[model samples]
Target: MSGTVSDYLLYRLNQWGVRRLYGYPGDGINGILGALGRNSEFQFIQARHEEMAAFMACAHAKFTGEPGVCLATSGPGAIHLLNGLYDAKLDHQPVVAIVGQQKSMGLGGHYQQEVDLPVLFKDVASEYTVMVSHPSAIRHAVDRALRIARAERTVTCIIIPNDVQESPYQRPPQVHGSIHSSVGYSEPRVVPKEQDLRRAAQVLNEGKKVAMLVGAGALNAADEIIEVADLLGAGVAKALLGKAVLPDELPFVTGSIGLLGTKPSWDMMMGCDTLLMVGTSFPYSEFLPPEGLARGVQIDLDGRMLAIRYPMEVPLTGDSQETLRALIPLLKRKEDRSWRDSIEKNVRQWWKVAEGQAMKEANPINPQRVVWELSPKLPDGVILAADSGSAANWFARDLKIRKGMMASLSGNLATMGCGVPYAIGAKFAYPERPVIALVGDGAMQMNGNAELVTVAKYWKEWKDPRFIILVLNNRDLNMVTWEQRVLAGDPKFPASQDLPDFPYARYAESIGLRGIRVDKPEQIARAWDEALSANRPVVLEAYVDPDVPPLPPHITLEQAKHFAEALFKGDEKAAGVVSQSIKAMVEQLKPHKS
Candidate 1:
């Protein structure tokens, strides 16, 4: 009276609340994929590559606050899953990675698809465990793995042996213990006294170049923080993860600050004599110049992050939203609009010079232009998951993100295949809102974006189209050679670009999805329209110049100097170019000339 192991797995997965499994199928894992197809609640997302599938699942977990799941066959297939799984671990996403093992007996004997997955994934997984040979023990191990992934907010790699996967008579899945979000509730750490808010307000009232800096923890207080900034005529800049905290058009916002920060943001941070660090644990203490440069005050839910980096003159411990409300009334009337106008001017003209060029440029299409086209078309508050390299730069410079449109562009960890998978996570979290997975063809191919099929299969059963992927298909390692030639100072820097002309568009189309490819400038709109109209997964292959760089709004005097010293060292033209960028930054800091 027993059924196939595949059917049992499907039933168990449904019980585990895994509506989607992003993966590619092979001999070891084909049984699971076929079983996935048979079920109504569970579906397989056949990824273009193992990494993308893992990345997609990671994205699903980030938003959903659940354990995102991905599957891969043994050996090389499982090896490709590492990059994205590691990315998930760093980004604080919970993903359950299932790798098909060779067999229980030949595990260490070195078969065709043999790899000690448990050992390989030990460091990456917050928890690692192997599957049970007995059908009765299967559900508990899986349930336990899911718990570890969610509770620890890290990846959990589980090795399912080929025999176990192909076996029959396994028990059905069930909810064992409690499953909940990792959102911690520390003891009311922020009980900001009335006097603290009063003092913080006093500082804001008196300062000339007053500014606000927001981080991930403070993201929830966006509106109230905006209100406080408006009252004091302050400028705003964000930590890396806080880029989308406010609307791109906000008057007081300068941009981000760090190694990847905009020049104007650095200038404004230096310009301001006083700063407010609201709800953030920005750890770049060295970047925040010495204590004399500015007097900083911070408000945070986690008091530990308040002064962890830079020392604070006035530290107000309270809930970000509550603290802002309590302090709003104590602010004195400040009449100067110059600082606000300065940032506005900087944001406006810089885009005009940089992104404007990209938008209007003709043939040998610009990547920036593709992103620019996307910005206006996306719904307000759309969460965009951007990858690293030229692709990240293009979207950062050209995409006009609105307030509350959360985006996470990880630092040099720069995992290329993160975009499409991240979109899956964000979509899982906010199913009602639009989530776009943006990436370049080079990076996509590197990470293996074939995971779209995995998502498509999942969507078919769930009847949800939470993922929309827009790929800039330049068909080469565009960013790699560009960084070497442009940033790395290798004039004779030979490009590492080598890619095949595959039918990426046709591939997506075959799977009951929408695919559009635009090689020419004029075709962008029509292709975009076709992709946008579909209420399912959309694959947009925008062919742009393989070597263009995405420049920020303003390059500072300090930054330009560094660039000259590093790249142009003895060259006058490089120095002149650096000089011009500084001049532009200075002009940016000026009052509105327009």
Candidate 2:
């Protein structure tokens, strides 16, 4: 369709329905850039850094159900994409990376900007990674990369040497030793066999007290999950990645399960006689029912992920929605309503405790209150992205996700610095929807601040300009600091956990976006309101207290002993920690007034 291999590459990608690309420019990719300039079909989004570009691509794939595409230069640029690619790989999102390379001839001679990119990308893009050594090879390279990425729901890489990119395109001849590829992919319909579904239904039907767990894989099967839960009289627990699989408003749905989970979820897992894990690889075995305590039935698209988290009596390998649809017909509704009623009661009580904890006093603002106020205020169809750290803790435990809204974060990688880039990517994919990013001071300092510039560059083009980034500026790596106390029985190490305070709101203002700062407890509600109503994107910076403990749902005796040890070891914030911890526990005990 064009002159150079670069032009043909873009044309091929366009044929594959890829209209947007996230990347940064470098001389190594000059050829591709030149082609992009001449082609108006592709919208090139320039990220502040290559790493952020990769993160954006991953997020795009996550939010849009398409294979996300990212481009980078050779050597350092390629290296920078690894972390974000790993985030995609670990989370099993489809993403295709197009990276530049040095001239083909100079590669083995220690050329500048040369790196063994194939080997470098081997593990992250283990499904497929190839270098285009010939002009004809570019055709098959682009084709296979995107196809594999989509089919596998994993990362794939294609390396193009500068010279090869500049060379004239060539169609593969219909001869021996030549490969020809085409542009097109349709996901196959996958439903487990009827017998397997019956077996799973039998396991679920036989148990009186059934518990269900869902993860990111179950997102598309929301209606089916609700039907299945209703039929089985099961209490559903969500993995962090699957926070939006079911609305928190469901009375029997226990919010999240893990270190940042709710008490009802822990109780459900502890007490259930049967478990039905649907499309989730919630790795924490401790949070799940102990082995042999409950008979389990697991359903996953990837068979490799089944029976690993818990020993399952039946493993159903198939698409979540289709599999659940088939299983629903075989499932018999449970007659007893007691188990469902208790779960609903606990759900109601947990919300009250969460709100009370949010209202409890802290030095400046309770982090829980920041999300709590925002929860009721979230608009329909709002897309939320949270970074890893204390912000994720609050986002996981406090925020009440509704049916229509979408939310996600770095789940398996648990990587920081993804919030802003992910929000940016979401805004690009769905320009009409409102997007919000929840991040901590540490993540903001790491890379979120720079991404504000990217946001500034593109906000004017969006259909609805209501992008918001809420930075919890606590001047500490709050999550890890608490982890030190709870997990390791060690006091806070200021050297590793302390973070320098920054004027996040002011920085947003300087970059031509609205900025709101909240320090007082009451200011949180108003700040969220103003930010949501503003004409342009706003940064709502809340100076929350780092000492407000992100207490787990059910604290173990070992965890309690460690907390005491950390305090006895002279933790820097021992006094504030003790006061806040006591208030949080006391608040949970008091009856809900509202």
Candidate 3:
């Protein structure tokens, strides 16, 4: 049988090396669905919701460094993809979204599912988006979407009308007006100019104290970064997206930066005389060296993102790995070891403080302890995904990323309900590796619970069925509650902040997966051990105390004032908040030495 345009679209995707698709089926995509039925080659992962599918696609891109493809029906299905697509856009991952629209003739008549998808997707898929109005258009549309998405490392869209999808496939005619497009893209080796590398090295070489900050863009450049850091005698700080860029075992590698950052990272940024930011546009300018205090040199693929956060003396626009490799020869190894020694000391002290905070007693369970205990238990080559909210705070600060592990979250978009989907996507990419999702109860309720069913359906097929979802089952919007006190000086509004309790572990048990529930602190480690050894996927729910605040590395005067004001304003948990805040603060000084 002659293939339809829908079949041709799948063929084009296969040619582009797309082996799997993450999406939910809908009536509007009936033609594509039929084509999928005919083709048995592609792995179509059916997520419970369209949004989860998009997140899965984004995660696939992040983990595999390939352009993730997602499918959706028009209108609402398309609308649901916005949040996850925005996540990929802000984080700069390549993703291609294929959408099904209403009949072409019905677009202007306000027919059902007739959305102006191009307009709807303009911002998210700003690199390229097109509606295939003709059968010949499908070829160019699919080709362009994949190419543009790969080249730009951004989202691109192709909207196919149902009628056009069902139409007989046609190659573009060999005429002047007809367009021809092809598959396959290879990244170019991009290195900064020799003069630019030397100029940047001169600034770095002249400094007495240097600090290095890296992000997701530096994930592939870890070796180069380590060499540079060693030569400069500098401390390295990781932006959240780059948590796994360098292992925490390095003496000079300070953990995450920004609000959820470690004290060592904050201290290194503040005290450094020179800053070398590689492949990271860490947004918190306040957390960086105060403007003119430190001379900066930044390396980024896009020149536009180079010096927006700090005033870089030299901005090298090139690939992080290639640029650093070139810049290495120009860099002189610093003779002074005092700066490096101080940084290592600080790193050691900060780890102790983290232990103190984690071990501090809470009402039932400390959220920090849950992740801290699991950090050492994490399998080699494990992949981690963390949801937004307090779980992210704990994941960022408590978990120690090893050399081979990979971890990511909704970094720029910081959306909830991404942890489960991202973990699922990671498992799909590397079924042999263990995968874990750290989720807050709010996020678990939002969408994680539903995705558990998806996990239950697919876990048996994975090469190593060791997937774990560790839910911090605190019955409150813990992050926002603390934010209200520390940022807005407002009391926790129970009507908005409080959450209904649900049996997450029991629910997992009901779905034929291992379930572990822990309220006592002593059970945290045992629960993690049991979940990791489980034959099937497991849900480990830790009922943590919401009052144990996720304190910032350094508290500001304004934040302190706000905290006092919130307490004065009759916050119901004022005593607990005050007590916990003091305990966390005291841990900074009384770090439990090993």
Question: For candidate 1, what's the RMSD?
Answer: 6.1
Per-residue alpha-carbon lDDT of model 2 for 369-425, expressed as tens digits? 999999999999999999999999999999999989999999999999999999999
lDDT accuracy of residue 25 in candidate 2: 95
- Higher lDDT: candidate 1 or 2? 2
lDDT against the true structure, each candidate: 0.68, 0.94, 0.93
The sequence of per-residue lDDT tens digits that candidate 1 reaches over residues 1-594 is 266666665666667677878887888776677677667786566677788777778767655556788999888998988888887777666788888877788877867868777788888884656555665555665666777676555688767777877778544445574232222222343458988777788878888878678875566678887888888888788776667777777756666665445656766776777888886666665456556777778987655556777778889777788888888888876788888778677656555554445654433576767777777787766778887767777565566678667787554356776776677656655666776777777656655355665566555443346457777776666566444434455422323455665666677889887778788877776766666667777788777765444344444465444454544444323443344334434444545433
**What's the TM-score of each model vs. the native?**
0.73, 0.99, 0.99
Prediction 2 global C-alpha lDDT: 0.94
**Residue 289 CA displacement from its true place in model 3, Å:** 0.2
Could you list the CA RMSD of all candidates, in the order they appear? 6.1, 1.0, 1.0
Candidate 3, residues 1-594, lDDT tens digits: the string is: 268999998998999999899998888898999999988999999999989999999999999999999999888998998899999999999999999999998889989777788899999999899999999888889889998998999999999998998999987889899998888788998888888888998999999999999999999999999999999999999999999999999999999998999999999999999999998879999899998999999999988798899888999999999999999988999988999999999999999999989999998888999999999999999999999999999899999999999999999889999999999999999999999999999999999999999999999889998999999998998999999999999988899999999999999999999899999999988899899999999999999989998888889999999999999999999988888878999999784454
